[model samples]
Target: MKRREFIASAAPLGLLFSLGLGDVPFANAQTAGGTPVPGGVLNVAVSPEPTLLTSAFITTMNIGQVSSKILEGLVSYDLNLQPVPALATSWSTAPDGLTVTFRLRQNVKWHDGKQFGAADVQYTLLEVWKKLHPFGRAAFANVTAVDTPDPHTVVIRLSSPAPYLINYINTYGAQILPRHLYEGKDVLTNPVNNAPVGTGPFVFKEWVKGSHVRLARNPDYWQKGQPYLDGVVFRFIPDAAARTVALEAGEIDVALGSSIPLSNLNKFQDKSRYSINLDDGRYLATIFLTQFNVRKPYFADKRVRQAFAHAIDRNALLKVVFLGYGKPATGPVPSSVVNYYAAQTRQYPYDLKKAAALLDEAGLKPGKDGKRLRIALDYDAGGGVTATRPAEFIKQSLARVGIEVELRGGDTASYLRRVFTDQDYDLMISSLHRLPDPTLGVQRLFWTRNIIKGAPWTNGSGYSNPRLDTIMEAAGREADVARRRALITEWQQIVQEDVPVLDLVEQTWVTVSTARFQKTALQGDGLFASYADAWLTPKKA
Candidate 1:
């Protein structure tokens, strides 16, 4: 696809009317603003206080949402889902495509007032990203070394061309960390994880455990007169109903990650106090998934996996669980990713008879109770009703096919431990941000090499297909957009057939904010946004 076509295709669905611009696009709405009034605390509602503050260790959207205020990557995705400058002022790739050079922004200071330069970017990529980040390890697998020619320039040398490296860096893979603070210490356990220091708009002030995380504006922020709010307070309200009540009662300025229940979305739709955006746009590339542990005997058989897929009623689940806020997903990549999304792939329509036949064909016979087999299902309770309700619905649907599902739930930590670390569950229902490019987000979920023992959100399924692996690797290395897209189409076909992870629904994540907050430019979902450019409009007298 041409650059302009791709940008338009990836742009957000139309702006909701609550913004009062009469259907103007969000990007254009920013330019229609009055003078930005600075000096008010933007209270945000986030479910389940973040377990970790650093994106270097885990890539959870919740952590990124909170950390983006204080931390910054080398590049960030604009409203069109295209990589734009962030900490790096400019960057260019060599003719051979094996090298990328970045020119750093000079005079930018970390939250601790230290100079932000090449060494920090070098350390972040070499020590942290390549070795630890879930997506980074795959995206930068071919990066041979990072060279700092001067104090303000970085040149990345790769063994082979990696077409998607820049996209990964722009997303969550390359969140720059200060070399001064973590150079000699235990990077993972360093105290800076809780009290992080970065060159972003906000300064880490205090984190009151179990209540809220508070951040104050950085007076010396490199971008002049930005980060209009005096501070931002992320209130930890785990209950979806409570978050809705808070938004309704004017207790919070914005609800991050669409924490409010979908059932209650209409409550605030036309309210004069708030506006709601439910299109999910290019910024929030995500899909609800039903992942299987391929190592387990029950799910090891592709027939059984296909049977389970047929048992799911995605349209009904969309209506009941998401309250018609999403579309039935056909595969791993969402339709919003227009460039590489494969529409011709095989689809599993809801059919209990077909599901039962597949189960019987797989050598499974129903018992006296008309149940074929028993297995455990798990999901993260911290995701609020959105995740939990879908798992419940799946359980009931699977039971109809003579599969007895034992439903389980836990907080975020336990969920990560059980699924990613322990590999304790037979099935897991979860959602993952699909990202604008497949290499940045999707590969890690299925690639065998990414099956890290303790890493959260890696390939926990223990699935390994040599052909699929080769296609993925080739796709990453291919610089030609047309050839790369064709390879991606083939990869999606294999994934849909393998059933390593069953795609359920493409969520239309709803983000609601009070009318007082204006020009909220979201960065990849509402999980992260350009808060520094966000300004608050004055309240009526």
Candidate 2:
């Protein structure tokens, strides 16, 4: 049976059991009024609290899984990563592809009991452009302004023609936030931060700090007879082992981010007792890289940078760090991103002999004591086991090349603030989780002026090229699809050669849930996909 149809038939029984309204005939779930047939609290486990609730700062998979449940973007991605309509019924782009106008659905309502309107679009665009909200700023960076001609119509004017504009607008950065609540002072600390209101199928009810969050069903959801469960509870479990344990023990209904290590992959798969969704490589996960402080004297020369890339065994490190979970990437863009990512692009293969030669070429040869180049390697140790091990492995590999490397680690928040954002490190390992488009990622990291004081979100590499900057600008405004792609490919080539950010691996996400919860039917650019029609079956009740 289809996942939705199967859920519709089984939800009543599960709801009856979950809500403790059991022994009542399952047929009574079919009420005449068709009001919310409520039951059950879907207990879930999330990893950590995101810096910000809105898409702007949703870096971790846990945050994406949680926010996706609460906020509904205008456009959502299908399993194949295709754009599908969500809030806006349909949209059309001008022939030039520089301007896009959307026809908003008139009947949608915000979770705070207010009518959702075009003003929400204006607020979101301005905030993203001005504040650097993390969900995705590059996607909307070229948008000159947003215009609302009517209550149900919104028009976006771009600086350049972009065929993929609609797809980007449907991403997380374009998520609609309630203007009425976030417009005033202390908006950051408003109860809404902890508790958000959205037009999505789920409504935020409670958040137990450092543990789990709860979301009740929105009876007034735009889509009728949807949101099969009464509510969804998201629990936070940082440890992958504990998360898997909770899932197997039924302490949690589902485990969202399942990039579990290979050693533990079988622990979840070995058990035929529980239904597991083995979607090892759903999306083209972006690269994990180390950015150097070009402003520092030690790494000022291009030869020094080239030497560093050549010193490390990327293939061996990939296997050790990911345990064969991912593939080593050669450039900023992943292979999955077609039209722009070229496989033939130059890659700096590992060779200690060449690395030593480059160091000599850069005039950073070893002293009489035989101690070669020394540099500080910093990483955000706050990601628990996932962040620490790879960081240590990178250090060890660098040492093998006779390079003196110092390991500096700190809490996630402090590290991101003092080291990365402040540009106070020699070298650091970091990863950008989401890149809807290749240009979006490149623009954020390489745009010259974007590295200024207020816009220091990216550019951690402290590397920029005037030629590439102009190409990025022209590409952003170029309306011709073919020409735009050509520019993107050229820019990527420049980035790869500069080696400001040494590309590493493309991660894979895994998910495990009960068979009652449909697997293939998941949707959107998140781990949970969509729960609009998801339902849990009762356990032999």
For each candidate, give its TM-score against the true structure: 0.86, 0.83
Instruction: Residues 343-437, candidate 1: write the lDDT tens digits.
Output: 99989999989999999999887999898899999876654444556778999999898889998888767887898899898998766667778
Q: Tens-digit lDDT track for model 2 on 60-113?
A: 345557776777778776545567788888898889777889888888899877
Which stretches in model 2 have alpha-carbon errors above 4 Å? Answer: 1-40, 50-61, 112-114, 127-138, 162-164, 180-186, 238-240, 259-263, 274-284, 453-456, 538-541
* Residue-level lDDT for 538 in candidate 1: 82
Q: Which segments of candidate 1 are over 4 A away from where they belong? A: 1-34, 279-284, 296-298, 365-369, 381-385, 410-425, 451-456, 520-522
Clashes of 2: 11
Tell me each candidate's RMSD, in Å, in order. Answer: 6.0, 9.6
CA lDDT of each prediction against the hidden true structure: 0.76, 0.63
**Number of backbone-clashing residue pairs for each candidate, in the order shown:** 3, 11
lDDT of 1: 0.76
Clashes of 1: 3
